[model samples]
Target: MTKRRGERPPVPEALPVPVVDAHTHLDACGAQTPEQVREILDRANAAGVDRVITVADDLASARWAAQAATWDERVFAAVALHPTRTSTFTDADRAELTALAARPRVVAIGETGLDYYWDYSPPAAQHDAFRWHIELSKLSGKTLMIHDRDAHDDVLKVLDEEGAPSTVVFHCFSGDLDFARACVERGFVLSFAGAVTFRNAGALREAAAWVPADHLLVETDAPFLTPHPFRGRPNEPYCANYTLRDIATLRDVDVADLASTVTRNAERVFNLGDVVQSQ
Candidate 1:
């Protein structure tokens, strides 16, 4: 007798991996459990996304991100109080964050920086927290993942004044070509996200074209900023392909080469050599 459909052999996995998503929010994207995270990462892997940096902006989400990273080989965590969430930061919170930053799975000190858009937290609080995270990065010797929104000048000023860490990444880079040139000159990495794929993102594309190969990276920033063709849909780590393809087109290079180069840049910045093994 013929075997039941349920007993059919499993299909082999797809090949030809895409670029790594240097920044994502798998934990904040409603993938709280191991099973949920596995499903997200599996989808990403199927889409040729070899790895992801799961960033958390608050204490609870930071803990969850760390746990997810520890449990999954594909997920690396970046823990810090995001600019919007700095309202609740306390001395105890700083101590806890310091301890968490020392953890093996925690690779960076952000999703932190300036955001004058929402002002969910006061500007002063955000600045104070940003400085605190900068110090934390210096102490831990980890990379700094910055999140600047409508506050580029101030962000740059603070970073320069605080003597930014050697490895600085501007996640979801929203600056112009001039800003990008300055960042390149300063040896800072600029990570493009889904927003770069939007039709109205000519300025972002121009910046992408100008970013040095060694300082270019990509991210999904999932559950938000989904790329074109999926712009309005809920984003996930798997959608990183669109950003990578768009960036490659802007840089006038083969997609594979761009992907490989950005992946190497990310690994270098986040110290993910041990995690991005197969990529």
Candidate 2:
């Protein structure tokens, strides 16, 4: 039989608590316009998601994401050029990003870092651009949302050498347990996405078990990595449900308690007080 909201199935554990999706891309996903974004946010809000950090990978989308945040109190913006989009990083792009970061709705400087998976941009160019973004985050004093894929060593090196802002989040963390431990050692927050719910994510689950409650976070990375039982379908902000459930399971904590902890963690790391209050 299907269990109720607060009811736990026969597992001897508490029911999973609902939670806020710490990171997402509601504006870019299926929602191509302001109206669509509004609808998506409405649905997410109804699902018990307290907030979403809508990120943008390019100048146009970044602008759109930032504007969406202005219209919806639950949405916050993180502006940056994804590593794959490094070719589009021009002086004009930098100028636009600088202006966007100055806005109150823009809470972080990223979705930026290395992605050696596709080699979309030359390694040298990506490195240079990553450094530029680091400088931008430092200058703005905003949290940094990093995307390190198949380039953890280089990403960590740059972060260490250049010195990331005090608040740095490793979004959609897919690294091994060792990497997770290393990140925790450096006081970095690891934001897990839907991938954590996949049956094959044993390593991720192990890492999650070790993550400090205060440093752990959850995200949908929506429009991608839809959690299992919903995989292969278009992802949305509301899909954060599965991710939060899985995280609570891994951490061996009640979902409600975990949700409350993560909410505080996201707020502290992303400076969400003013943004959340304004919403």
Candidate 3:
């Protein structure tokens, strides 16, 4: 049957081992209330995606993401103003973001970096915001989650100039193999999203195949980038399971082994040990 446009994909079969959706936007996925959040997570858990890191793109979402994290033991948060939205970033915004970063369940500072694809925010503003986020990550001792879109060189340049955080993760990594090698060489973690499963993402697949287990992670980036066979559909955290299966096939590794490795990587990067234990 031809699925209608914007239809949500059916929950996939459970994975041999559970994995985490290293990045997603629960708010954008229509999970605002505690009941809504649990309903979404329950679907994901059934498909073997046991935990998730819900990322924010602005102050409002950042606040929601942090609050949502506290609501569910299986959910964590990354707070930041997205690069494209940085044009209007203010001191008041910084103060609030700093406070949000300190929240116990806010495990990362990010979804911040360059995004040349959209002109919503000027480059200068984006650069300044990205640098500030880098500092915030260091100060808070949390992983830095980057959203690099069509400005890879500048993203790395800015990080280099400001000394990257001890733990760096490129969310929804869209780079080719060469760029992947550059990030890996710098010890930055590369997180593949649903886009990696796209048929034309050959270079991305190559990079996915080459990344070492410890440096690799997977995400759904839900409410967007639905994986193949269901591309263009509405996506939620549960879809990370499908992306994980594709990556496992791409790497020619056992699905269970890959799940375990990425789950461990997610736990280490996001400091999710206690969260997982409580779950």
Ranking of predictions according to TM-score: 3, 1, 2
Candidate 1 per-residue C-alpha lDDT over 1-279 given as tens digits, one digit per residue, 9 for 90 to 100: 223322312212332445678899986578878999999888888878878899988999888888898778888899999999998788999998999998887899998999999968999999999999999999998899999999999999999999989999999999999999988888899999989988898998889888889999889898788777566667788788777877788788988788788877877888887544523
Q: What TM-score, to 2 decimals, does candidate 1 have? A: 0.92
User: Residue by residue across 113-143, what tens digits does model 3's lDDT show?
Assistant: 9999999999999999999999999999989
lDDT of each: 0.85, 0.82, 0.93
Please give the TM-score that candidate 2 achieves against the real structure.
0.91
Clashes of each: 1, 2, 0
Once fitted onto the true fold, the runs of candidate 3 whose alpha carbons sit more than 4 angstroms away are 274-279
Kindly give the stretch of ten consecutive residues in candidate 3 with the minimal lDDT sum. Answer: 270-279
Off by over 4 Å in 1: 1-17, 274-279
Pick the winner on lDDT between candidates 2 and 3. 3
With candidate 3 superimposed using the best TM-score fit, by how many Å does residue 274's alpha carbon deviate from the native?
4.7
Q: CA lDDT of 242 in candidate 2?
A: 69
